[model samples]
Target: MPNQSTNGPSGRPKPECDPIKDEKMGLMREVGGQAVWSLSSCKPGFGVDQLRDNCLETYWQSDGPQPHLVNIQFRRKTTIQDVCIYADYKLDESYTPNRISVRAGNHFHDLQEVELMDLSEPNGWVVIPLKDSNDSPIRAFLIQIAVLSNHQNGRDTHIRQIKVHSPVQNSIVSVLDFPINFTTVQMAQHSTIR
Candidate 1:
């Protein structure tokens, strides 16, 4: 008789984890919903809601001229480590963003460009890490996504989704890294003699 078991000698199934499919697979905290979102222009039905609904079929369609903007503002300053944007060139074609610029600052008036990306017919989620010259995460209260151009010179743009992530320190690792504050006498006092 042929054996049909697929498990290893340990009798444990293999763990399956795909980074692309898992939205929060890394040590990062998603903070997109905590901020206020605004768009430069949008169609009646296609707006920020569609972009954040986590549905690939739905997208935020801009109706204005070139350089469409999506502004995200937070009440308090926060560290921004990465930005993920979903775009389908096959579905949206010319509406897909070809050039993107990310800006960060305390406010709109003082916004400075942090990263510039040029995509060539991207079809899935593109993650752009925001880092300073010193390789540290950017700290700001405002973040903006600017679509400078679209595929095939399209004026408007279609963004399926956007996610902002901040670096997270593992609790266990942080606890282990903490300095030992108690002296030997203090440690002994806490130990049970019985």
Candidate 2:
């Protein structure tokens, strides 16, 4: 239902030009396999489930023996407001907090954890905001959640879903445009009713 239009050389529509038609034709083209990973199930160490269910028994460690890492990629620049990391305390009963490491752009230097909040609901979500002064525009990023020795092999962490807002400049190829009333009326009267 949204009307999308591209600016032409002149303000008015050019001869034999229909913005809606062009967009519809473009949509016919197939752009396949663009996403790196689709977040489907909550695995053992992704740190997503904790936030989805509003629990924080999972913790990350850096100096511990084994370190768990979650890798994620955004096809384009995105304005991320909140991030959720999930983990289970089923394995460990300790109350020690885990360290969360974030990396953007490359591995040259990592971004420090800006904010960490416990989910309000019993099994809700852990919301982490991307408001750090040092936070840079990110297309691809990685999170490392390491469990301390005290909590190792005790808690199972799972990353389920990540929600973000549309970037200022969204993917041009994915843009869609709608037809005006003239075409709408014509299709409604003449098109096959299936």
Candidate 3:
């Protein structure tokens, strides 16, 4: 057998990746489109549509003052585990967000700050957890992303993409779906190891 060590076959230590983060992207479902996306101020042709178009070339560019905002409002209460934002420091330079704030509540008027983060120099998708210290996902009707500042103190900012994710709920499996509804005892007797 080949090496079964932490270094694997390459003999280089594997980069550590948060399994929860990987699950958020791989197993979870994207529910951002279920909400209404709004922006504080955006340049024409570079608005919410571009920010969520799932493309890297297009981006949402803020046109107004500091503290650019992107708001997500749901019709009903939603569970959000994390928010992913794609940014390129090399490409956007001064327009790259340096500080970000996440807020959530029932509405805009009663929004409460959830998390504040400072990004040094990001060049790819940055995932921010919406969970509390107890590791519970945030449940709210409104979720907001505020760009407090940008690199090099740039007034406007460019955000290539944004995604809101929630853990995938396992669908209930029933042994009674067949034409002959199976009883509990019948299921137990018929069950086999695959």
Candidate 4:
């Protein structure tokens, strides 16, 4: 069983993930790509997949101790300027990160520290701008949680969502191939879930 963060008439937290709000990475939809995304550790049913849903209801909850990590690898070099993280939206104060360390590079072992963010009060979603010395793209990026907020009596760190910002690569256009005799009015007559 899981402990409910809120009950009764608690208010819903602000939604920070507006996929269509930011024009840069906003207009682009999440698609299957060569980039590899992984988490160092997560509780069952809460994994990296939840981070892409754009909804706060689903999230990635970290297991074990502090310093949980989120790692990403690109198929080719990609330029990313900022990263957004939504946490504690439902008021699950426990496990919110106080400080975060960013590491990135072309190679895994060769990754270097790029930036660090210190949140005195870790409460809502944050947009962190990544700094690249050369101002160029990299092949990999990593985020490590250095400190966790006190929960009073709770376990596990919770992250409601995460988004990586980068230039839109490929645009997919779905073509509808209906019956040759089918007219526009007929095609639009009814809709099917399939």
Per-model C-alpha lDDT, please?
A: 0.82, 0.34, 0.83, 0.59
lDDT per residue, candidate 4, 1-194, as tens digits? 11122211254533454544765445543322346788878889899788667687888888876667777777666666656677672366656665666677776677776656654344555656555556554335343323334344345677777766665666565444443454588675554435
**What's the true lDDT of residue 157 in model 1?**
95
**Model 3: residue 34 alpha-carbon error in angstroms:** 0.4
Q: Which ranges of candidate 4 are over 4 A from the true structure?
A: 1-20, 23-34, 134-155, 167-194
Question: Total clashing residue pairs per candidate?
Answer: 0, 22, 0, 0
**Error in Å for residue 94 of model 4:** 1.8
lDDT of 1 by residue, 26-71 (tens): 5567889899999999999899999898788999999999799999
CA lDDT, candidate 1, residue 127 = 73
Error of 1 at 48 (Å): 0.6
Best by lDDT: 3
lDDT for residue 176 in candidate 1, whole number 0-100: 46
Error of 1 at 139 (Å): 0.6
Better of 2 and 3 by lDDT: 3
How far does residue 130 in candidate 2 sit from its true spot (Å)? 1.3
Clashing pairs in 3: none
Which prediction has more favorable lDDT, 1 or 3?
3
TM for candidate 4 is 0.63
